[model samples]
Target: MKYIIGLAGIVLVFLLAFVASSDRKRIRYRPLIVMIVLQAILAFVLLNTGVGSFLIGGFASTFEHLLSYAAEGVNFVFGGLANVNEAPFFLNVLLPIVFISALIGILQYIKVLPFIIKYIGLVLSKVNGMGKLESFNAVASAILGQSEVFISVKKQLGAMPRHRLYTLCASAMSTVSMSIVGAYMELIKPEYVVTALVLNLFGGFIIASIINPYEVDPKEDILEIQEEEKQSFFEMLGEYIMDGFKVATTVAAMLIGFVALIAMINGIFSGIFGISFQDLLGYIFAPFAFLMGIPWGDAVQAGSIMATKMVSNEFVAMTTLTNATGLSARAIGIVSVFLVSFANFSSIGIIAGAVKGLHSKQGNEVARFGLKLLYGATLVSVLSATIAGLFM
Candidate 1:
């Protein structure tokens, strides 16, 4: 029965995209069907089978080890402040991103990450029936982040058409950066994060191909990275360390502000309406949650988390999920997968600003289509969660 609902959710998602499609007639059903079928299969393999159990166990343990290693840096700086007795989420969970970012930088400096993203992206492009750049952005965005991936393709930003540009930005918005994957693992099951990452990679393309259909000229489907002047090995490491710290501080600041503000807003709404703002939103989003295979009884609570992810960010939503009670395992699984993307309201500014910093006119165009990007990316998240729901 849950699988049936999940299947219906998938169809509804594509129909929603198709109805709002910029060029409905040009929507490629072949790639869309292939991607959805692939997502379903991948979700099953990752969640229900023995191979998935072994893979997820290794992934969780590996991330756990990395989190332990990251704790070393946290211990060195704050010492007893981050001691296990009373370590806060910011210090223990979020700050580890600094270490992860440093590791990513090391991987990038050695050219290991770029080579992998390029070729993996090349293969994905062939399967997804999109341009090489669009496919590369999806994988790169998963690793490098939404904003930073643009720098990797900065050379081509100016020349790419609007439709292709939308595809790139959509992929970025739909996927989460690896820097925070540990933090997510701390809050939710690692399998959901891992599965969501893979599903959203394809889900982003499926929705984008429908909503923003266009043909990439084979002659212009470039996969070249923009080269930068070489810095000494130590210089690069130091730079990455600083960059990691910046990312950590940025997330910490956002969490403090957003979480506190949400608390205050919920207070006001509760005072006046006899219900919290999130509860009201939950009621509003409950139907969508139900369609995603959440039991009707749990739909309101699940929808609240979903709405929270869109309004604030996934971190805040995941925090809520971690502390939540009365939800079934299936509801938790679907909600956890849903909160894995960077598809919130604030990302509009972040993505557009990132592009604007590189190219002004194109950034303005992205800004104009900002809401559409959010709509499409949010659908990508829903699609992934729905598919994961079937197997869970």
Candidate 2:
């Protein structure tokens, strides 16, 4: 029965994207259908089978273990203040990005990560029938993160057309950074995070192909990414370490403001209207939640989390999910998958600013389509969640 509903959800999501497609005649249903089937198969294997367990679960455990090493660094500096159970949220959750970012730098310096990204993306381009640049950007976004991914392709940013640029940003907005994957595992099930990462890769392409359909001219299909400026090993390591610290602190600041503001808004709503703000948003989003295979009884609560993710950010929504009660395990799994991306209000500005800093004109172009970018990425998250529902 759940599988039936899950199948219906996939159809509904595709229908929604099709309804908004720029050119129905130009829509490549073959790739769309292929990816949808692939999403379902991947979700099923990762969530249900032993192979999935060894892949997703093993990765999560290994990642969590890696994060423990970060804790040692945290303990070194802050002593008892870094113990997660006793430490503040930023201390335990956000600070570890510094270590992870350093590791990313080391991998890049050794040229190991680029080879993997290049090959995987080349393979995906064949399946998605998109340009190599698009495929590479999607995979790079997953690995390097949203803003950082743009730097990987900065040389081409000024030259690429708007439609291709949108696809790149959409991929960035749909996938979470590896640096924060551990923080996500701290909030939701690690397997769901891992699966969402995989599913969103295709989901971003599926939606972008429909909404921003444009053929990449053979002349513009170049995949020449600009390498970062040369630096000594320690010099590069120092830069990434500081960059990671900036990320951690920025996130901490945003959480402070957004979380507090949400509390205040909820207080006002409850005081005057006898309901919290999220509850009201939930009511608005409940039908969609139901269509995603959430039980009707839990739909409102799940919808609230969904609304929170769109209005604010995934971390805020995941925090809410952590404290939520009475939701079915299936609901938890589906919603966890849903909240695993950067498909929120704040990400639009983040992506735009990153581009603007590199190329002001191109950045302005990104801002012009910012809302639409969020729309496509949100659909990417919906597609992933719906497929996850099938396996759950």
Candidate 3:
């Protein structure tokens, strides 16, 4: 029964993408079919197999050690604020991003990341039937982040067409940055985070192919990465450390503001309508949750978290998911996978601004299709969660 519903959910996602497709005739079914099969196989391997357990365990253990090392820095700077037993969110969960970000910088500095990103992207381009630049952006976006990823391809930004630009932004919004993956592991099970990361990579392409289909002209398929200005090792390390701190502080501010605002709105709604705002959103999103194979009884709560992610951000939604009660393990796993992407209203502006900073005209093009980009990316998340449901 669950398998039937999961299959139906995939069909529903394709139908939604079809409705929004700019050129319905250009939608490629072959790659979409192949990718969907791959998603199922990967999800099964990652969620149900011994090998998957070993890999996820190893990945989780590595992050656990990294977070502990990061805690050493945090304790040195802000040692006495909290009690010994209590773990503060900002210190324990968010600040570790700084350490992870610096590690990413070291990898980038030594060119290890670029080498892996380029060759992996080349392999992906062959499978996805997209241009090398598009495949590279998707992989780079996962590692470097949405805004920073554009800097790597700044040379191609100005020359990119609307169709290609849409694909680029869609990939950025569908995957989370590697720098924050540790932060995410702190909030949810590591296996779900790892599964979502891999599934969303393929899911982004699947939805983009359907909604923004275009054949890359072989002659125009050039990929020129923008090289960063050379800096001494220490100089580069300091910059990434600062960048990581900024991201941590920025996320802290967003949580402070968004969590309070949502509380206020929930209070107002409860006062007037005898129900909370998120509960109302849950009611609206419940059907989609149901489609993802969450039990009908728990779908409303799961849907609310899914809607929270779309409206606010993944961090807020993950926090909510952690606090939520009465949800079955299956529903929790499905929603955890669903909340792993940057498919929120705010990301449209973030991606647009990132591009606009590089190429004004191209950034404007991104803003024009901002909502469509979010739509496709959200579908990508839904598709990933749905495929994951088949195995769970």
Candidate 4:
């Protein structure tokens, strides 16, 4: 029964992607079929197998240790703000990003990260039937982040055509930055976070191939990563440390604003319509939730949380998911997988602005296709979650 629903969910996702395809005739099925099979196998291994459990456990434990180390720094700076048992979200969750970001900088400085991103991307390009640059951007986006990933490829920013640029941005929105992975694990199950990260990587390509099909001319598929200006080790370390803090504070600010606004809107809707705004959104998104193998009884609540991620951001939705009651564990797992990407409305502007800062004309091109970009990215999340639902 679960298999039937999961297969139907896959069909529904593909059909939706097919309907929006810019060039349905040009869509390649061979690579898509290969990737879909890969997604399922990977999902099964990650969710059900012993080796998968060991890997996820190690990954989660490593992040846990990293967060503990980060907490020492937080304690030194703001020791008395909260008791050990009652740490604030900003301190407990957001500040650890600073440490992880610094670690990424160290890896970047030593060139290890670039080496890994490059070779893995080369291997993925062979399977995904895309250009080296697109595959690199997808991998780099997962590690470096959406905005920072563009800086790595800034040399080709101006030269990329609209279709290729859409693919680039789609990958950025489909995957989460590694810096925030620990933060997400804190809000949901660590295993689900790991599963979503792997699934979304391939899912990004699968949906992009369908919705924005095009051939990459090998001659034009050159990948020239923009090298960062050389800085002394301490100089680089300080810079990353500050960058991490800025990200932490920025997320904290968004949480404050988005959470309050949602509360206000929910209040107004409840006052007038006897239904909270999220409940209204739940009704609209419930079918997608149901189609993703969430049981019909749980779909409405699951859909509301999914809608929250799309409209506000994943943090807000994850927080809601944590507080939500009456959802079965399976429903929670499926929804947790669904909320792991940067597929919200705000990301369109972020990706566009990131490109615009690099090259004005190319940024404008990103903005023009911004909605389509989000559409493809959201489908990527749905496809990944549906694939995950099969094994769960």
Candidate 5:
């Protein structure tokens, strides 16, 4: 009954969104419909199959142990606060963001990440018709943020076609920042992180390809990334650590400011509704969370996180999701995937601001493509959840 409602609602939402779309000619339902069907199959396996149920048990346990390993990292970094009974908010939460940024830098220096990029680029090239460098940067951005990943491909950005440039921005918006990956790994599941990486990589390729489908040239992108031109392994790793520090600081600052702003806005809404802002968030997004396979008992609480994520940032949502009580592990998995991207309203301004700042010449062009990117990211995240939900 629940999944029935979810499927119906998803169909309705898609149809309604489609109707509202002024450019009906460009709507290609192929990927969208395929994703929907996949979501249904996923829901069925989770709900009905004993095999699926057992598999979830394995994944859930493995996820628990993986989190424990991550917790060790947290504990090592912040000793006394490591007590499981009372996790330190700053050490466990903020510091992990700092740590993962450093780790990404470390991985990149070791050339471990480059190999991953090569394989990822190959897959994207074959699957989505993207060039090797474009796909490499997209995959790298999964491990690096917008500015940092740009470093990996800084030279290429200036010369890339307008369509590819937009794709880069869109992919950045659609994926998680590497700095927070460790925290999210502990919050959700290792399998979940791995799955998101896979989906983000796939989504970057597929969605970008859909937005800019020109097979006109088979040549590699004119822009070449030059991360290895001057630095040796140790030097590069140090640079990555420094880069991570810069990124972590920037993100921490953004989160602090953004969180305060959200509280202020929610407070304004709170006065109108005569309920606390959190309560209002819980009231509204609960139904959608319910459709995404969150247990009814935890739906409202989990919905609050989802709503916060949609309105503000996924980091806050993940923080709320990790901290929220009275939720089943399966439900957590579902919500984690649902909250796994830059889908909220805040991202609109972020993209608009960033794109406009850099591409002032095509600022209007950037604005024109903004909503499509948003819609595409939303579809990708939700569709990834549905695929992952089946595994749950």
Candidate 6:
């Protein structure tokens, strides 16, 4: 019965995703839509059913090749640093983020992402019915992060209509940068880098479209096809090193701030309530953990990690997962990756203000849609977790 309900929900979300169309301030999304239903079923099957166990095993088995690939990277860079059987945390976590960021950056130079943007933007153009510039920003922001991805379409940003600008800004705030993709893999599971990347791509596409879906009319002639020189392999490699520096620093900073904030919050809770803040958060998100297929015995302990992700960044959530001493294996995999995001409550203002930049005159609309985008992004990640839980 749980499986039945869960599977049914996935179907529902897919339906809603299709109907999530817009035209001039009127969202035509059919309630109980496909995307929402798909997400719901995914949560059920992954979290509530025994299916998660099987999926977890499958995820390992299927991604076995990744272990080999990862090993190759370790051997090339830091031989003896990685055990073939046990992927060392540093190699698995840090290197992937750095390498992938560079790889994506080089791809950006070659215009691969732009090509993808144009293709996706064309489809989104129909759903959003917005200017090419706005649609382009949406596609670019999803694959890349806020400031970096905007470089790809910087010209569009300055000239885009206010409503379209808001959409693009909302999308940037709603997603993570490519720079941190590898670290998430290291934290969740060495193999999940690919999965998280794919999921991030999907999450961005979905949320951007949802934000102010009916705000604009289409304009293609205004959109241009910009071209650029491909970087030589050495040049691209150099670019990665530069990008790696920036990403690593940003990640380090986030880790420091969030880690400190968690410590501060924990101190307060312990001082005032005479209980651990983690324990409180655990209970707060326990039902959600249960929904993600964690065994009832360890759900709240796991849910606290989810709470941390919602309040902080996914890195902090993964850090908590790694540091957590008594959690069951059942709680480990599903919760780690599922809780990964820039989905914290603090993101509400960050994303809104970012998008508000696009709308010089419509900061109010940007503010309203920013909240919706954050919720949508969080919901989609929950959907990611619930679905991934089944596979766990």
TM-score of every model versus the real structure: 0.98, 0.97, 0.99, 0.99, 0.74, 0.69
RMSD of each: 1.1, 1.3, 0.7, 0.8, 4.8, 6.3
Which is better, 1 or 3, measured by lDDT? 3
Q: On TM-score, who's better, 3 or 6?
A: 3
Q: Once superposed on the true structure, which residue ranges of model 2 sit more than 4 Å away at CA?
A: 82-87
- Global lDDT of each candidate: 0.91, 0.91, 0.95, 0.94, 0.64, 0.60
Write candidate 5's Cα lDDT for 42-158 as tens digits: 555654577656765675565455445555776786677456687654565555554455566677777888788768766655545556666676776676665445556655555
In model 6, the runs with Cα more than 4 Å from the true position are: 4-25, 30-92, 120-139, 159-163, 190-196, 199-211, 220-222, 225-240, 325-330, 345-372, 390-392
Tell me the lDDT of model 3 at 88: 92
Give the C-alpha miss distance for residue 229 in model 1, angstroms: 2.5
How well is each residue in 2-61 modelled by candidate 2, as lDDT tens digits?
777877887787788788776777778788888888988999899999999999878988
Which prediction has more favorable TM-score, 1 or 6?
Answer: 1
Residues 1-392 of candidate 4 have per-residue lDDT tens digits of 87888888889888888999999999999999999989999999999999999999999999999999988998899899887678589989999999999999999999999999999999999999999999999999999998999999999988888899999999999999999999999999999999999999999999999999999988898989899999999999999999999899989999999999999999999999999999999999999899898999999999999999999999999999999999999999999999999999999999999999999999999999999999989999999999899999
What shift in Å separates residue 312 of candidate 3 from its native position after superposition? 0.6
Ranking by lDDT: 3, 4, 1, 2, 5, 6
Candidate 5 TM-score over all chains jointly? 0.74
Give the Å shift of residue 311 in candidate 5. Answer: 2.4
- State the local distance difference test value for candidate 1: 0.91
Query: Which regions of candidate 1 fall more than 4 Å away from where they truly are?
Result: 82-84
By TM-score, how accurate is candidate 6?
0.69
